[model samples]
Target: MKSMPLKLALVAGLGLAFAGATTYAPPASAQVYVTQVGVAPPPPRFERVPPPRYGYVWAPGYWRWDGYRHRHVWVSGYWVHGRPGYVWHPAYWDHAPGGWRFRNGYWAR
Candidate 1:
């Protein structure tokens, strides 16, 4: 009979402890939004282009996102006219907390 009262008190104590924990919410400053990682794009595409013409350089192929299908599609590489003192930077995908972000390649001097 005495043990029964002790058991009841133990259970009540534990219940109150848990209830107290959930009753309070963390402050906004303490909350952090985390982005989920996403599946990466498929393998790269291969294309054979003829020799560069008119000082054009080959910009490598890259993946493009298709919003309609919610997937990535291969964009064929093509020849672009070379800038006098710029370098061709290819497009690439970058990892973000919630998903992937596509960074467009550009001509960097």
Candidate 2:
């Protein structure tokens, strides 16, 4: 009788733990729009390009602005799956009236 109640409690605890784990959601990987006034990102850093990968395109690294640190940070290059009919536009920084604006890489026809 005592053993039965203990087993029941253990099973209930495990079920609750599993239920909590299932409800957890990870943070999104989307980038946020940021505009820095009177600040320009540093020059692009040199990264050794890896050997070509089948059906993939190498996206070069670039300087990314760090808002918290108020400076530029180097983001490493990575391979992206190639799209048959689209071109991969690498991210770049452009001069704007207010400041330097960041344009994200995108696929275009």
Candidate 3:
């Protein structure tokens, strides 16, 4: 009989925990284009890093945040012909409270 009350209490506790976990508010999105002093200029242009001796296409350059400042960084794009039906999503930045956050580009099929 005593075990019944203990079991009920355990169930109630678990229900409260689950409810609290689901009620959490998500953090606000960060800012992406805030410029700070001492930020380094974009990296020098170089010959396109040839794609893997295959048919991969090259994507252009973009800016990225370097822990300290925003620096222009080139993420050499590649040709992905295997997935014929896929489309490339170019990389982008999101502004956050801290600084610019880079979202890596990806291929979508």
Candidate 4:
């Protein structure tokens, strides 16, 4: 029957997918420290603030490209607990010949 061949193809495709699942690497964006994708990401959107909290510092939102989706996603800013003697450095994208590379945020002492 025609359906028999279609079912076989579907099974084969699924088999291949499962077989390669373990070997799949994270998207190139995660591994790339820098990119020259050419176009600059849009400016970060505004974050609303509530009354100041005692010990939390603000982590500003920024855009990170979803390489798999081929689009920019907004990483929303949030409050992080303050570390004594350390300043939280927000993540930012730097432009180069290879486009913008993301610098991960960190607490710099």
Candidate 5:
């Protein structure tokens, strides 16, 4: 008799937890825009860094946001190891309502 009420409460608690988990808000979208000041200078020409192994790849340079200048700064080019089934997207600066925004480079598997 007492166990019946306890079992009902347990089921109701589990149901509420599952419902809350499924109702979580989705992540906000990435903002994209252009900014004149945030443009980065051309990357310096230099000898390419040797790949760690034969299959490694090079990820190119890009600009990053600098808060003090209200502009973007250059992050130099570098080599990265290639993953078996991934592609590297170079980083870039985008203007947004807030200010100049930087999107970091990433390897997409």
Candidate 6:
């Protein structure tokens, strides 16, 4: 019957709509706060930074803690789009009373 074809078209349209909705992901605005104690990370390593890009800021490299290996690992730096009226803060580790706290790189005024 003619109605069968009409119903199939409607179902196909709905399927495509739902498929795209499932793949949608929201943009991330902030980094998760992570902290550790006991073993402090080794001294920061010297990295030769490349020439700066016109419209991007270079984020310096830093050591990140590997929970499974139980040691600090080096994370390479990269460039990010420059935000107007904001400064990019590089990630770093700070020693405090309990342990070392990892501050995520963020855009700040």
| TM-score winner | 6
Q: What is the TM-score of each candidate against the true structure?
A: 0.59, 0.66, 0.36, 0.62, 0.45, 0.69
**Deviation from native of the Cα of residue 41 in model 3, angstroms:** 9.1
Ranking by TM-score: 6, 2, 4, 1, 5, 3
Candidate 2 residue-wise lDDT, 3-103, digit = tens: 99999999999999998985554343345354555788877888999999987889999888777898888899998777677777888888988888887
**Collision pairs in model 1:** 35-97, 35-98, 36-98
lDDT, model 2: 0.79
In the predicted model 2, the residue pairs found to clash are none
Residue range 27-98, candidate 3, lDDT tens digits: 333322344334444543565666464534455555655554445655555444433455556556555655
- Residue 1 deviation, candidate 2, in Å? 34
Of candidate 5, the 10-residue stretch with the lowest lDDT total is: 25-34
Looking at model 1, report the run of 10 residues with the lowest lDDT sum: 27-36
Q: Candidate 6 residues 4-52, lDDT tens each?
A: 9999999999999998985554444567477776788898888899998
Give the alpha carbon lDDT tens digit for every residue of 1-109 in model 4: 9999999999999999997984453322322244445568888898886677787888888898887888788999887767667767778888776667777767764
In order, the Cα lDDT scores of the candidates are: 0.71, 0.79, 0.55, 0.74, 0.62, 0.83
Q: Candidate order by lDDT, highest to lowest? A: 6, 2, 4, 1, 5, 3
Model 1, residue 35: C-alpha shift (Å): 14
- The reply for model 5, stretches above 4 Å from the true place, is 1-53, 66-71
Which residues of candidate 4, in runs, are more than 4 Å off? Answer: 1-36
Kindly indicate the candidate among 1 and 5 with the higher TM-score.
1
lDDT of 1 at 4: 98
Candidate 4 to truth, TM: 0.62
Give the Å error, residue 109, model 4: 1.6
Count of steric clashes across candidates, in order: 3, 0, 8, 5, 0, 0
